[model samples]
Target: MSAIELEKDGGLWTVTLNRPDKANSLTRAMLEELADIAEAAVDARVLILTGRGRVFSAGADLDEAKAGLALSPVWERLSGAIAALPGLSIAALNGTLAGGAMGMALACDLRIAVPGAKFFYPVMKLGFLPQPSDPARMAALVGPSRAKLILMGGQKIEAPEALQMGLVDRIVEGEALLDTARGIAADTLTAKPEIATGIKRLCQG
Candidate 1:
């Protein structure tokens, strides 16, 4: 099966991280596929990113790290693609989010996660810089103080704390996570397209 899956319903497109056995850790192939999906989703009015199982993404595949391959460039490209989407972007984090994958989530306009989900960015503790786009995006979402707590302090923030810190927009439990995201997407449809797109781009910056 593919490491990434794309499903479209009308103008809503969902991009799923499908490597459940590996906690949806990203591989080169997966990153490439995601970038392609993002690039090809111009017709989508709303894009939702989520994981297939209990974990959103554990970040880069350690095998790639061990092989001495540079994954930063690929991550940069992928995050940039998601950020550049003309319409609204939503991240439906079904479970925990950590490491490099946090960048992709931060790129989204809104983040809705399950109650069991946790958020962490451990790059500094792992002795590496996060993807270039991560820090600013993280700071934008939760402010510089909270961003430092996660990125530099390597704090493991649970759902409640995450919501308090503004790391996640909403915490809906179980199947309600996706349902709520779809509802938000439907609400966005009521806005004027050009106005919504313009406001979205402005907020993204």
Candidate 2:
């Protein structure tokens, strides 16, 4: 089966990390594919990132990371593509988000996760720095010290705490996760393209 799945429903593009057995841990090929999808999503009015099963992603595949995927530029490329999207981007985290997987979610315009989800980035203990834009994007959402607590201190944050810290925008029930994300995208999906894109641009400013 494909590790990544892309579904296009008109201007609403949903990207799903599909390797549930692997906790959807990203591989180089998966990362590249995700980057490609993001880059090609320019015409999308809304993009929703989510995963199957009980975990969004556990970051790089261990074997691949041992071979240097940990420092690959594709991570940055994928996140950058998502961040540069003119449309609204939402990370509907299905479950825990850990390690480098944090980058893509951090780049999204809004993040909403299930109540059981946990958030952590353990680059410090793993002896690798986060993707180029991760720290800044993370800090922009959660303040420097909190970003430090997760990155430097390697503290795992629960969904409620994540929302309180401004990391996640909302905590939703597992069943309602994707529905909520879709609801949030409804306005963007129906708005005139230029108007939606303009609001996104202005907010980023």
lDDT (Cα atoms) of all candidates against the true structure: 0.86, 0.95
- Candidate 1 residue lDDT tens string, 103-190: 8898888999999998888887767888889999888878999899888888999999889888898899978888889999986666
The residue-by-residue lDDT of candidate 2 on 1-205, one tens digit each, is: 8989999999999999999999999999999999999999998999999999999999999999999999999999999999999999999999999999999999999999999999989888878888889999999999999999999988999999999999999999999999999999999999999999898888878
Candidate 2 residues lying further than 4 Å off, grouped into runs, are none
What are the models' TM-scores?
0.94, 0.99
Clashes of each: 0, 0
Pairs clashing within candidate 1: none
Q: Which 10 consecutive positions of candidate 1 have the poorest summed lDDT? A: 65-74
**Residue pairs that clash (backbone atoms under 3 angstroms), model 2:** none
Give the Å shift of residue 146 in candidate 1. Answer: 1.5
